[model samples]
Target: AQRHSGAAMAEQGRQRMADDRCNAGGTAEHARPGDPLRQHREEEVGRERGLHGALRLRRRVALLGHLGLQHVLRPPAAPLLGQGPAGARAEVPPHAGRAAGNYPMATMVYFQCVFAAITLILLAGSLLGRMNIRAWMIFVPLWLTFSYTIGAFSLWGGGFLFQWGVMDYSGGYVIHLSSGIAGFTAAYWVGPRSTKDRERFPPNNVLLMLAGAGILWMGWAGFNGGDPYAANLDSSIAVLNTNICAATSLLVWTSLDVIFFKKPSVIGAVQGMITGLVCITPGAGLVQGWAAIVMGILSGSIPWFTMMVVHKRSKLLQRVDDTLGVFHTHAVAGFLGGVTTGLFAEPTLCSMFVPVTNSRGAFYGGSGGMQLLKQVVGALFIVGWNVVVTSIICLV
Candidate 1:
């Protein structure tokens, strides 16, 4: 019992150290896995102190397309931002920002690849059994090269949108929104599954689906938490918000199912869980816990309305073969999250995680109104880009 007590005390010490590092904002001296400041400054000043730097550098340098020259700048290439002339590596000094080290160069490419693959998988969900394997095989490289890379660059990778101060804390636009829209677009191209199949596409295994959903819910912690690039208070809050929003969404969805259909549904609960996660992701660490609850409640009902009522009412929506309703779940919920983020993002929290100075949600009533506009415009840009790029890929 004494030994266990000592261990617990040690853990508390570590946590307090981490919190210190997080608040003071020092270099990533111990960032082996990119631990944010959690103690006194270490000797080596880490590259990309927080998410701002992480977004501008880590994912930017990492999300190289298969065949795009502009995205990937290899070693001898000139530094992107430095105290030197615009061109030529020899002209730039080594001590300039981002020129000192190849942080996140090869080591971080896998992270971008994983996200890109996730977007692809979500796109596939809408066409699930109907898409041709050969076509899908051909489609993956093209879409990744064209669609995914562009969005990553434009948003998180420090393109025009990032400069415009559009906040997508964890790929609300880049991954979820893009995939949802692309999935719907691709489904349109592929046409609906067989009438008989569409009419009765029962799950082959509910138990397996439940297990998969559970695994996904667990992983979502990393998905939102890792974005802060540290395990500091913001990261902790993000993880907590993820779980809170998901649980609230699941309950709300289940309650709605019971009220409308007179029974609880496992499927509805899963959908609720997903929407909740997607909804909070944009501002998971940026908003307060109370805001997370509000977002979850909206996520639960809005997507439900879109999927249950709107889908049923809209003939055009009916024409599209969105098998798993990825459009409603991801696209709608992602958009909701983005808008809510512009509305609820707290100033202090935003300062910790968001790179932009004086960034706050509309609820704070400063530049938040304009921030909301940016969110809407950002959504429109994503929607338009995916619709065009995915369609071109499908046709080709």
Candidate 2:
């Protein structure tokens, strides 16, 4: 009786094992059709694919900001007025032509947007750590429409200055000069940061600041290069000149810091870099390599003196609290660039890049002296316009 019971128990155990195997095999075979886990995984995969597609679409839209849609959409023509001698229309080269479309109209819209955006960013420098959010929200749109547009039209859009033959290579007047003056004006109205914050303000992250500076430096390739409205030889030369000036400026500034402050501050280096970049922008392509180095050295030293030495001594500068010293970096550097461009702009390069026919620097003789006067006049107009407009905007 005991043996028979044991055999029955063993048979029952085998049957249970067989049932477990069958269930496992059945689940594997039917997983895709009915399993909840498998269905959830498929749904997850679909969501991921959709997310990737959306990211790709967003990337393409961002790229359009750099490559003007008008250029991509329409055929090219003389993109700006006064392209050649005596207002003669210059034919666009194929490569440069390929990048620009719809001539003055579409390209104008795109460039105006670019310049407007940059101006807003520069203006923000003065308002940092202070300024009411609501006021800024209102200020930007109004400033863009009223102030920036006026400058853009007057300078580049065949308005008074365009016809008058005022040359602004990549917005020395429209962007830097305007922003610097406007920023300083606005800061006066907005009031200064709290006393404690002003006295002890320190950068939150040096590494992050450096990273941002690096991006700014690299992006300049497009900043000055795109002003030509095409990918051309002038664009290439502008990019090279931009780097040359920036590097020279950085070295000069670092050297000054080491001599005076006894330490080479990274922040100081970045400031020097910016001043150098701003200094060369007015004639990035219209100046030779040697001219770029000269501009850089002056940009680095002059701004340093104004910011470090003059700022400390001047009561007005001390009282105003021009944060980041936009006045020194943008205003002073920009004006200096304009003056030097007048003095050093290579005649051959000027003819190629500037729309003003027979344009030459002061060094080249002829109407070169007149050109320098025009640069100063252009800067004055910008300064006056910005001061008035910015003050009104802030006051209101």
Q: In lDDT terms, which candidate is top?
A: 1
User: lDDT by residue for model 1 over 221-340, one digit each (tens)?
Assistant: 999987765445677778999999999999999999999999999999999999999999888988999999999999999999999999999999999999999999999999999999
List the candidate 1 regions with Cα displacement exceeding 4 Å: 1-106
Report the CA-based lDDT of candidate 2 relative to the real structure: 0.81
Model 2 residue pairs with clashes? none
Pairs that collide in candidate 1 are: 17-38, 18-38, 21-37, 21-38, 22-37
Which ranges in model 2 have alpha carbons more than 4 Å from their true place? 1-108
